[model samples]
Target: MTETLVRIDGVTKRFLENGTPAVEALTAQIKSGQVTGLVGPDGAGKTTLLRLIAGLLLIDDGTLRVCGFDPKTHAAPLHRVVAYMPQRFGLYEDMSVIENLELYADLRSVIGTERDEAFARLLSFTGLESFTGRLAGALSGGMKQKLGLACALIKRPRLLLLDEPSVGVDPLSRRELWRLVYELVDQDIGVVWSTAYLDEAERCASVLLLSEGKALYQGPPQALTRSLEGRTFQVRNISGERRAVLARALERPAVIDGVIQGRSVRLVVGKGGVAPAPGDIGAGPEAVIAAVPPRFEDAFMDLLGGGPRGRSPFADAYASREHPIDSVVEAQDLTRRFGTFTAADGIHFRVKRGEIFGLIGPNGAGKSTIFKMLCGLLRPTSGTARVVGLDLAKAPSEARARLGYMAQKFSLYGDLSVRQNLEFFAGVYGLGGRRRRDALKRMVETFALGPHLDVDASTLPLGFKQRLALACAVMHDPDVLFLDEPTSGVDPRTRREFWSHINAMVANGVTVMVTTHFLDEAEYCDRTALVYRGRIIATGAPDDLKERARGAGRSDPTLEDAFIALVEADDRESLA
Candidate 1:
């Protein structure tokens, strides 16, 4: 029999927000040498539940135990036997890797050979050995996450709790992080991993699906995916008109959910008791309909309101028309360097009006550098960038006025209420009187911010924060929108809503330049530019990029597969 590492029964936690329970009567167990995933959307209480078990928050009711210690009263002792890594790992940017590790070891009271041994093992497992002298802040997003994991593992605790470690990491880095987790599990460490990615949840031995402070279901991930096996089907658009056909299919009441796949639409049917049929969406004679296996995401969404509406509610408002527009963003031999480190070199790309252009690369590949240069936040060392036909370098203020930029991190005033943040951005964009008032009201209504108007921006859920950020970025209705990792750490439902608005805006002739680690999202882009080591390595449509990956040895590659294949090939060539 396996030992139970952490146990919770009838646990309840309430927040100060009008006595709302963040976690309600949750019951679960973590077993030694096993990976248990806490899976849910933002604001679903995954974070609250993890905090309860970590003893960061007091449980309002019921029993909770960590490594045989009562977390409520014996949190200090529990801390010694358990390690917890929050969403943002507390690593100092100025501190070197070894310095951060040593600080954590000293806090844990590790000394002498034990400290040295711990550092050796951790650095080897996390692949940070060569970067020991590098500053933690200087590491790539993925490397920083690895360093964070190493610091948490210094004590070699019996139980480990991680909250969204791969939130903004590239797919390859995400896979590497999981590999480290599996290695630790092999040594009998009980792991409780919380994530918004459904694909990651499928890797766990068991899963607890939480929503609205409640445990909706608990079981193996396969059980969830297997439940929807026969109900899922693929609608192939033989003419390759994926987006148009998808938009049409979503209008049918029978389609519960659908996403654009390569040359096809994957649909989950029978929402209103009507079976999905080709005729329902008016499929042409060339269309092919076939049953396909459902993924964990399909079943997960079913539990969340029978999946998202097949169509975006914001689509009609922002994307109802077709318009001819000129190039909104142009880059010519753009390059940037800091000291001896070249961040971006001779990068070139052009985004036409009403097009969604995805800029994808591994962490540290200089995507952000290019974005900053194009947005006029950073001047390029050489070459030129233009936004809305205005030179970003010489006429930055003019260019900026016509564009909206959302950074990777939530950059709103956390101390202010939701309304305050909106009004602040409105004022910053130079709106006055009725325009300001009307814009604020329109955003509140469009993004469904009615219930959160009075809430502090910092206290809102991750999903709401994302919405608020986008609302503030586009408060001025700029002609060009720059979103940098906008959907990072957000759940699928929230991401769908985000892109719906994006699609709508593009439909209305708003050009968008986006940087995202979620390679799957590349499918939504009309074109994608692959960046690596500060250079534009490949540029083409999503399908063209996938073909490139297939040529490089991937069999029927997904967007991520294509990206990994390309990056790995480049790495091999550099090594040679």
Candidate 2:
């Protein structure tokens, strides 16, 4: 028999957290030629596990053998054959896409004979053919993600560890990503993919469910799902947004798992949460309801127990005060182009105070092009974009000064403390002395960083780092906020909390312009514009768009269905 690709014999990894354990002792194994997924919510010890396998973290106990090499002691030798891509894989923003690929190839020490061929193959697989000349900063969320993957693939490692590889990608790009992974597995590479999306995990050969530094379940996704067959029921609530009531019902101990589906929640029966008898749960079982097949989501909810049904802390704590947004932002036939390609075609929109505006689209739909243009990072090819009545093209500095922009993957100096990072940005915003110190203190405290203020940014967890980024972005008290997929890869609870902060900022009359991939997130925006092929094809409130989606021939659609339908329609229209 072929040798096992990875063997972890009771490996335990832990970090000192106020003298408490962060991750407990855990044991797991991954076989060869199979894609094993690490599935969990935020802070579930997914990243920590990957780091441990990559030899980046010391194992407090037990042993790990990757192809017979001990990652802890043989780091240099193991590094020669395995590839680990962290959540924020470094991609040089100022360099062209091709340049970045070549750089990675050189770093891996690929021979000249196969270097060109390797680069071409990686770029082609990533769908970055025509984007070779585009600066890394100019690529969309999906494109940048693909670029990161391509660079990792350039090394042709036998073992691949990818962290949340498809979080912000669109459906088309997601399919392509899967294709690439399949090809890698076909090449006999063992892949360990970490993700929050359980549906994605179903595609893997086996799954290891992690919870708070422990393995909750490990087996074939199919078998684990079959073990709980006939336990789940598709349920719906009569009233919309009254979902709070439905969620409460599903939370009983008897309900093994429940997931939100458009207007209703699919529930799996468990110990304490008994299925509400006929008429007991709105329309009881056998009330002409669909008995849906169990999905990875059902299995996930079963494993973790039903999670919180509301927004994250950032969303819940929104302090809405009346700050009339005076001339928030205006765009008139704003245009951006790349050679013969028009990235933004005659775009026009006005954002007002207390408004939560969103840009929704497919992977290469040019949403990022417009976002960059709005932030003054990329000049418009034609027309004008105004911020607080200041024209970005003519008065770039004046326009940029009125707004705060957070990139999709926000960065911080790894060596700096949370307070230091806050102080640096505060200074950039021109506040200093007593005000800077006070603001720094307030930001550090508000984001719950007071305890970790002295900890280096590099030592912080993903959620903490995200909060630090938010603190830095708004420390200057800007009038408008532009966030590009700010919640991607974040925990569902944290995502909810992040939205609360956004809502709070809007309540204070701060204009919010955001982009996101979580369909449920679309519901939070006051208004969303569906962008496709460089144009706004549909614009309205979430409910309004749902109605339009039904009119477009999809019945009883969720925000995801509405999104795909609108994006498809936009594509067809553009083709026509």
Candidate 3:
């Protein structure tokens, strides 16, 4: 039998959110050398549970124990043996990588030879050896996440509480981090990992599904998917636009959940509903419909009471038009360097109006650098970038006025209210009086930020934050949109909603250039460009890239698999 590392009995945590329990009567067991996944929609009490386990929040009722010590009374002792990495780690951005590691080690009471040994192992394990002297702020998003993991592991704690550690990380780095966590589990460390990604939860030995602070299900991941086997099916011949097909699927009461997958739609047929025929949704006789094994995401979405509701309020913002200009965005031999390191080298790409272009790469592959240069946030070391026929180097003001950019992190003022943030952005965009009011109203209704209008931006849930950020970026409704991992920590449903709004904009002639770590999201793009070691390795439609890898005997490879194959193939060619 497996040994239990932590146990909770009838635990409850309450807050004054109109007087209710954030977590009520929650009970679960986390086993040693095992991974326990905590998953739910935004504001589902996942973080509250982790905080309760870490002694950061007191349990209002019942009992809790970690390593045989009560978390409420033995908080000091629990702190020493538990390492909790919150959504945003407290690393000093001005410090060097080694300095930040040393600071964390000191805080954890690791010193001298022990500290040296831990740093060496962690740096090597995370592939950060060469970046030791680099400043923390200069590192890529994936590298920073790995560094946070290294800091969390510096003390070698017996239990690790990781909250959305892979939020903005790329697929490759996520795999690497999980591999390291598996190694730690071999050393008898227990992990309670909270994630918004159902795929990540599937990697855990067991999962605790929480909803409104209540434990809905606690079992192996496969068991949940197993329960929904025949109910899931793929709808083919979705000839309409992605959102149109999605709207059609969701319109049927028999469809509980649906998402755009490749050229078709994957959905879970509601309980007691029969398989959908080709003609059921206006498909021709050539359309294919078949039942497939359910995935963790499909099951989770069903538990969330089906997919997102309501049509996107931003639907009518654009009207389809023929583009007079061939290219909405253009880059010519764009290069950026930091001393001896070339972050982007001779990169070139063109995005047509009404197109969704995706930039994908491994961590530190210069995707962000290229994005910054295109957005005019960074000057290229050589060459040029143009937006809407305006050269950014020569006419930066004109170029920037037509671009809407959202950085990877939430860049809004945390202390400000949602309404204040909207007003502030509106003013910055040169809207005045009635125009500002109209813009703010439009954004509030479109992103569904009504209830959160009075709340502080920092306190809103991750999903709401994403909505506000996107709203702020598009308040001016520029001709081109640049998003840098905008949906990083957002839940899958919210991600679909976001893409729906974006697709609507594209259909109305707004060009978009986005960089994302989620490979599945690449399917929504018109084309994707893969970068490695600061160079474009491959660029094509998602289907085209997948077909290229299919030639290597991999049947129907995912975008992630095709990405890895392409990167490896590029490495081999460079070596040759």
Candidate 4:
């Protein structure tokens, strides 16, 4: 049986962004008892749609309905049955996790027996019992989102609306959050989830694909993907190999889109278009462009790249370095503690120069703790860390100066313009004259920031900001680069391009130590350390780690499979 929970009839919203249409009139429908993914780019009016449904934004035209009530006309009554968690969930930072939940329950009119029952169940379900006394500000990104969802669950609303609940969250936490969402729906609750990832969209029952605030399609994510499913040519190439020629061949007007996967290329050729024959793609190179099935990512690229959407670009310089990491960073018995909590317990790892090392873990696996200590942002509770062959604790400043860091949020000065931000960082890092000018010019050209050079960094899109942060990190040519979840919230195409830059740096002999919540990225790392409960639980090549994943209860596991199995095993052990 098909269920329809929320419906939008000719829903339209428009706003003047510097005197332009921020959104166009759009119509969408969300089914009840099913997860509906609202997928699109950064400013494709994702947030606006959520606002219209939440009654926070009044549509310029058309009608919107939720649970049979008009959102604009009967917001109070409609809100009673709906829960909306906006992009940045506002919580009292000073309040304890339990205190925050109690407040939300009171505000939502959840009281006494029902509230207490929900609280207890939520604590156990989310495994948050230990942090009830911890401040909201102290909770990790995943914990905070879980708390946010718990607060929303206080009212037991029939409809749930989430805007990128898993955004910026670690992969394990993301999977857990989705599990909780499924649990809610099993209880007959309706969920309307919005995200930019096609992978996440695969889990949805239906999807409302929006572009420039207009609905392009509305149906099951799978069906929508299957609609245009047809011939795709899979071309294989080495990661750092000369795959650009194959891409260039498909770049003609006849081709729709081309993508890189591990060591293969998925090229979509337009029907009746002028494209190189599969056999004639490259005369000498062993590139095979064989027909294959259409992936969700392929479908997404088709919709996105089929039109005249703006492109994001950045430089991927492959300049070689004279010196290698004769041991870029080495740690022995690294430990970190927060009060009585052990974040990283006796962790040990080594980062070599020119190596692309990926650090991954479950949400509470203590990856961040190790990253902070390695970057010298936090002091270790015990043991030592040697960065660039020097002790981190003894000469922190010099060690820091030798490393470039792109924080989780990119943390570039928001108010400053692209050029201004670049110049500021360059000056701070003691860059001067021709060198600074050349670097700035190259970055502007590479990231396609030429037009928006004067625009505030905050005004840029998520993907652009990701590129800018990376550019800034590489501006001074630091010997070591530390990126903490640098690709979070970025689209898939942009993520690929960003990896291109990282690969260039590795080739240039600048050691890269990265921590990412993305499991697929684990494939790019020469070696990976799976940190869990403040210890190195697994360390090896991605394939080897995948084998360990099978030991954790996953057969024929991918990186994501390994990640989830490891975390779930740890959790079960904890409960036992």
Candidate 5:
């Protein structure tokens, strides 16, 4: 029989006097030897619920018990049996990996032989045995996450709480993280994983879906996904541009959600809403409409009132400007070296006018290095990068003036209000007077950010932060836009909203070069380049790469399958 690790009844927590509760009347049970996913959108109280379980926060009302102890009255004992890893794990960057592990062991009082055994086991399990001497500051994004997990497990607690552990991790690393957590579950450790990725939630033993601090559903992910069956479909053989078709489909009252998948548009029709025909969605006479398997994302969007609809106001406001050159972004033998290490080795790619080119790879695979060199943030070691026919090395400022960049992390001033950040970026991009005011007004209206104009950028939710970042990035309306993981930790609906604007911009002849870990998002790109260990291993359309990985037992493969297969094959060749 499985042990019930946590029990909650009518729990409520609020941070403000009159504001909505962060968590309201939540009731659930978490069992040992199982993974319970706390899934929700930004500010959905997922984090608050996790914190309550770990005894980090007190519930205002309701009965709560963890490991048979009242958290509010017995937090100390609860802490001994529980381990909480926050979104930002407190790893000391200046310390070596081994030193950091030892520090955590000391904090947990696991000294001598026990500490030594735990360190050895963790290092081996996380694949960090070879890099134990490296500094934490120099570790890759995925490696840092593993190290944090190792530290969290130093005490070997019975319950584990993870807050978005795989936020910016690559697919391969994310799979490994899941493996590590399940290994602990096999030992009767209860795990609660909070995440924005619906696919991940689908793998959990059970999921607690939250919205506006209230529980919308609590059960197996399949239960929710099953409800969306017969309503999900694939619209194929599009006569017009796929993006245009998707935009048109989203406008229909019957369509709850729609997105570009390969060459077709995947849609979810509202319950009791009429199913759309090919002609209804602007498809050609020969276009085919087929009912497809429902996914967890479809159900999530359905419960959340669907994603943003209608054409992007930002795209509508963008006036098309012609560039004399055909290729807007060109990188020829781009190379960048740091001391004894080469970060980018002879990389070459080109983005034609009005194209969306994607650069994707594992963590620390030099995608960001190539992006920085092209954007003039870093100088190339031996080759040339140009934007709008201007050499970045010789005419960096001139080249940059025609570019818009959004970093992997939010780069706006946290202390500044939403309005202030917009004003600052506008000035930096040379907008003034009526033009600046008009741009701000348009951005506020486009992203629906009018309500939070005076709020600090740092205080905004994850989705709003992403919107603000994008609004500032495109306020200048540059000819070329560079986005580095623009939708890294946002929810599916937020991603749809972001891509809607991006697709609109591309249709209007604006060129875009983006790097992302979300392979699904790569489907929107005209072409993609796969970088690995400072080199381009493959470059082609998403379907092309998927075809390359298809063989033997697998006739059809997902983008993630192709990514893993390609990387594994390369690893084997390197070993040989």
Candidate 6:
């Protein structure tokens, strides 16, 4: 029999007296040598529950035990046996990699030979052995995550709590992180991973799903995913644009959720709802409504009352603007360098009017460098970039006026109210008087931001913050929109909603250039360019890329498979 590391019985926690409980009446057991995922959307009490288990937060009611000890009464002792790595793990930026490790060791009372052995083992395990002298600030996103994980393991706790450990990292690094965690689990350590990514939850031995502070399900993810088996399908041979077909399919009462999957639209019919016929989705007589395998994400959205439906109000309110040029964004031999280090090598790509182009790669692979060059936020050392026929280097301001950019992190004013942020962005974008008022009003209505108007931006939920950011980015109605990891840590339902708005805008002749870590999201792009070591290793449609990476024993390939295969192949060639 496996040992139970944590036992919660009717546990509840609340930050505000009158406000709803952050976690309410939650009961679950976590066992050693296994991963138990805490799956939920934003503000679903995942973090609160993890904190309660770590003894960082006291339960308001019921009993909670960690390692057979009451956490409420034995907080300090419990802390020694449990390690909690929050979403933003604290790593001293100014310190070297070794210095950060040493500091963490000092804090955990891991000294002398024990500290040295731990450091060596962790550095090797995390693949940070050669970067010991490097500054923590200079590490890539994935490297920082590895460093954080290493720091958390310095004391070798019995139970490990990780909150969104794979949020901003690339697929390659995410795989590595999973490997590291499972290795620890093999050593009899219990791990409770809190994540917005349902796919990760699917890999867990068991999952405790929460929604609005209530336990919705507690079982193997396969149990939930199995429930959606026959109801899921792929609509192929589309006669019209795939996005438009998807939008129409989602609006149907019978369809619970739909998303653009490569050349086809994947739909999930409501339980017992009849699947659509060929003609229903504007497809040809040869169209196929093939039943497909169900995933944890499909089940997750269904449990959340199905993803956002119908047409996007933002797209409906958007006024179409004509551009004389077919290519809205162009990068020719775009290169950027920091001293002797070449961040972005000579690269070339073009985004046609109304096209969704994705730039994807591993961390530090020059995607961000190229994005900055195109956005006029950073100047290219050589070559040129253009937006709407204006040269970015010579006419950055004019080019910027025709483009909208949403940064990786939320860029709105946290201290200001939602309405204030909207108005402020409107004014910054040069909308004045009636134009400003109309823009703000449309944003509020389209994004359903009326109720959040008086709420400070910082207090809004993750999904709301994403909506507000997108609203602010498009308030000016620019011809081209740039999104950098727009849905990094967002839940599947919220991501579907966000993409619905994006697809709508794209249908209305707005061009989009995006960079994302989620490989599944790359399916939405009409074309994708894979950047490896500052060079474009591959560029094509999602299916084309997958086909390129296909080989024996792997007949069906996902975008992530293509990503890893292509990147690793490039690495081998370079080494040879």
- Alpha carbon lDDT of each predicted model: 0.85, 0.75, 0.86, 0.76, 0.91, 0.90
lDDT preference between candidates 1 and 3, better one: 3
Error of model 4, residue 35, in angstroms: 1.0
lDDT of 6 by residue, 1-576 (tens): 579999999998989988899988888899999999999888899988988888888899989999988986888888889988888748999999999999989988998899889998999999999999999999988999999999999988999999999998999999999999999999999999999988799899999999999998999999999999899999987776888788777778999998888888899999889888878777667788999999998998889888887788866777777788888999999999999999999999888999999999999999988998999999999999999999998998999999999998888899999989998888789999898888888889888899999999998988899999999999899899999999999988889889988988988899999999998888999999999889999999999999987995679989999999999999999999
Query: How many backbone clashes does every candidate have?
Result: 0, 17, 0, 8, 0, 0
TM-score of 4: 0.87
TM-score of 5: 0.98
TM-score of each: 0.94, 0.74, 0.94, 0.87, 0.98, 0.98
Task: Estimate, for each residue in 1-576, the C-alpha lDDT of model 2 and write its tens digit.
Answer: 234778877777656644433456677788768899988877788888888888888787787888789986788878877888787747899999989988988888886878988877887888799899999987876788889988888878879999988887876677668888899988888999998666688899999888888888888999878755677776643343323434454446565444444445556776444565424545444343345667676667666665444333433333444444455777789889899999889999888776778888887777878888888999998988887778888899877877888887657788998778887888778997887877676676667788898899988877788889888888777878888878877765466456556655664567888887776666667678888888888888776788777865666666777887777776687689
lDDT of 1 by residue, 405-431 (tens): 999999999999999999889989999
Better of 1 and 2 by TM-score: 1
| Poorest lDDT segment (10 consecutive residues) of candidate 3 | 238-247
Question: For residues 423-532, could you state the per-residue lDDT of candidate 5 as single tens digits?
Answer: 99998999998998898998999999999999999999989999999999998888999999999878888899899999989988899999998888888988999999
RMSD, each candidate, Å? Answer: 2.4, 5.8, 2.2, 3.8, 1.2, 1.2
Error of 1 at 311 (Å): 6.4
Model 1: weakest 10-residue lDDT segment is 316-325
How accurate locally is residue 219 in candidate 1, as Cα lDDT from 0 to 100?
87
Between prediction 1 and prediction 4, which has the larger TM-score? Answer: 1
The TM-score of candidate 2 is 0.74
lDDT of 1 at 345: 95
If the candidates were sorted by their lDDT against the true structure, best first, what order would they fall in?
A: 5, 6, 3, 1, 4, 2
